[model samples]
Target: MRIDLHTHSTRSDGTDAPGDLVRKAKLEGLDAIALTDHDATEGWDEAQAAADEVGLRLIRGIEISTQFEGLSVHLLGYEFDPTHEPLVQELGRVLGGRNDRLPRLLDKLAGLGMPLTEQDVLAGARDAAAWGRPHVADAMIAKGYIKDRDEAFRDWLVPGKPAYVGRYSADLFEAVRLVCQAGGKPVIAHAWARDSGTKITPELLAELTEAGLAGLEIDHPDHDARDRAALAAIADDLGLAKTGSSDHHGTGKGPAFHLGANLTDPAELERLLA
Candidate 1:
């Protein structure tokens, strides 16, 4: 009954390939896992195939980047129709933004005397459907500029860092609306992390719930105990389903993340998929 509803693969920022992710999930004894890769559904087919072979339940999902009150927010969409026109178009735009931002990021890095080329980033991206900051970080690692993803973010990629560059994201309300329009459930990912909680107040959650946000990610590695409790209370108050997930980005993210580390309640999973 353990369900980890948010994960990624090489199709996005995660180090593992889609098939390997499913096999690992099965080995980890996860009853179910969702391949919620950033902005793309490209990993679904491979992950699903591996899930079938491994006898693991797979939930097709995307971790969409979004903007709310000028801060970055991630929207987890589950069981959505991938071919939905609006969703497809929006994802393309998001992916394009990711692609477009790279050169600028590289330029900034170059200005800071840490030169990297688009080819370098693409080399790290491999077959990823979307190229993003994590891939850039991977490029930095490959070039021996930084030891790992964390260092890359800390020293260069994160906001306020020398190599940081802003990119396009869908509006939060529009993202929620589009997920519901595409017949999917939308849950705010890590709603309370990194001062996001200050922006995503109960009042805002209530507003988002009205806009078709179905769930709150109440349990996450980044959330403090007080934050989790507060979010759970908000979910209850707003009648929103509550989900928990590892937000696993594979080994590069850190040692703390693992399959089923933070799990969604079966009852909540049912509610989410309802």
Candidate 2:
């Protein structure tokens, strides 16, 4: 069966609505797709309903932002009850931080000579509920702020960049706990990126695994052959799962990879859902 366990919707930073994502998935002939929006479950109800309409199995999921040793990371939660109190509370804090940071980032961008306004971003991000970089990037693209998403990050949105601001994020251990407590399987999202230097080390994976890390996201647009080999080795050594996924974010995110583009096997999905 074709399954893509990681994806987003406009509920967070993705470009499409949950229903649109469902339609796209069906067009691709995906057997299943997970609507792992960031830090919010409001989209889940819509996604689930749409999945039922399209006859596609839906996995309740989210990609929560988190921190580990001061670096930013995203935790993927699958099969979880989105309203679990503790998880909800933690996600609230993250959202609050997200809401607060965007304004500061926009101001910072202005200071750095980028002509941007909150209204511009708000208008562009229309349904993004929680403010995010993608909205800012869209505004940037519209305003000719930097050429595109990559340029925006390279100039102002990346860590330590002029417009960079931090959000209140959970640690790897806490993120894992929340996912498990919410009855979800916790997986690390998109860990194999060598060009931008986002590599998930074995030691880091071990630490998270000790704290209930369920899997590593070995499939992503940024991962090269070497990156995949290293991730596969790390998963083997640690007895952790290595997943193949597209990490699709609609268009303008480079060659749109489909649901099963990088999947190494189907066994892991069955094992996880079990």
Candidate 3:
């Protein structure tokens, strides 16, 4: 069965609503899709309902914002109890950081002569539980400031860029512990992408494995063949499940990140769900 284990919806950075994302996955012939919206699980119920309607398997998951050695990390937690108190509280802090950084980011952009109001960003965010850089990029797109989210991040939003702003994130090790405590499988999402490979070494992966990291997202839009090979070797050595996914964000992300662009092997899916 085809399974794309990472995605987002309008409850976070994605442009599609929860139901629409699931329905589109069905159309794309995906047997299963995980709704891993950044730092929030608000989309779960709606997405699950749609998945049931379409006879699609829905993996309820969350992409947690985390930090390791001062660099950003994304942790994907699958099949967790959403009401797990510690995890819920930590997510609240992470979402708060996203919201807290907005004005500063906008102010920096304004200084660069691309003025925007909170309303502008919020309009783009729509049903998102918290505003994020993608929403800011959307505002920039609407104002003709940038062609797409990629350009916005490449030119302005990414770290070391003009509009970049720091925000609080959970400690990566603690996050893994919390996911495991919540009775979930914790996977590193695109662990070696977006310059994160510099920090996510084999040594680090081994360390995180000890901390209950159950898998690695081995195939992603940002990972080249070399990156995949290197990560695969590490996963093999550590006995971690290897996952593949589209990281779909609907129109919010680029075309290459469409639904089912990459898929988890059925055996791997069984291992992950085991």
lDDT of 3 at 136: 94
RMSD of 1: 1.2
Query: Candidate 1 — what's its lDDT?
Result: 0.90
Residue 103 CA error for candidate 3 (Å)? 1.0
lDDT of each: 0.90, 0.79, 0.93
lDDT of 3 by residue, 1-274 (tens): 9999999999999989999999999999999999999999999999999999999999999999999888788999999999999999999999999999999998999999999999999888989999999999999999999999889988899888888999999999999999999999999999878555354778888999998989999999989999898899899999999999999999877787999999999899789879
TM-score for all predictions?
A: 0.97, 0.93, 0.98
Candidate 3: residue pairs that collide: none
Residue range 101-201, candidate 1, lDDT tens digits: 98898899889877888898888787898789999888888888889888887778877777889999999999999999999999999988853435477
Query: Largest lDDT belongs to which candidate?
Result: 3
Worst 10 contiguous positions by lDDT, candidate 3: 192-201
> 1 or 2: which has the higher lDDT?
1
